[model samples]
Target: MKIVFLIAAMMATGLIDSAVAAPKSSKQRCEIVKKKIRDIESRMRAGYSASQGIRLEQRLRELKKDRYRYCR
Candidate 1:
C-alpha cells in the first residue's frame, strides 16, 4: 500500500510538471508571428531592395501559414 501511494504521487507530480512546461497557445504563437511580420516590413521600408522585400514578404506568408496550420 505504501509503494502504491508513492507511485501515484510521483505520477501526479510528473503530470503537473508536464502541464507547466507545455508550449504556448495558438493565439500567442500567432501574435509572435504577427510581430515578426511587422518587424520585417519595417526593415524593408528602411532601405531593403524591392526584390529582397518581396522575398521577405513571401517568407513571412509561408511562416504565417505554417504557424496557422501547426500552432492550432
Candidate 2:
C-alpha cells in the first residue's frame, strides 16, 4: 500500500538523520572533554600542589583516552 511505503520511507529518513547527527554530537562532546583537560593542565601549571596536580593529570589522561576511543 502507498501508506505502508510512506511509513517505511519516513522511518528510513529518520534513521539517516539520526546517523548524521550522532557524529556531530560525538565530536562536540570530545571537544568539550579536551577543553576540560586543557583547563586542568593549566591549573596544574598554575602552582597547584603536587597531590592535586597528580590527580588532575590522571583525570586528563583518562579524558584523552576516552577522546581517542570515542571521537577518533
Best by TM-score: 2
Candidate 2 structure quality by residue, lDDT tens digits, 41-72? 66667776777567666877887896886678
lDDT, model 2: 0.63
Clashes per candidate (backbone, < 3 Å): 0, 0
Error of 1 at 19 (Å): 21
**What is candidate 1's CA lDDT for residue 68?**
77
lDDT of 1 by residue, 1-72 (tens): 997885685345321122344347767666656666566666667786677667667866776785777557
lDDT against true structure, model 1:
0.60
- Candidate 1 C-alpha error for residue 4, in Å: 55
What TM-score would each prediction reach against the true structure?
A: 0.48, 0.58
Stretches of model 1 off by over 4 angstroms after superposition: 1-23, 64-72
Candidate-wise lDDT, in order? 0.60, 0.63
On the 0 to 100 scale, the lDDT of residue 21 in model 2 is 33
The alpha-carbon deviation from the true structure for residue 6 of candidate 1, after best TM-score superposition, in angstroms, is 54
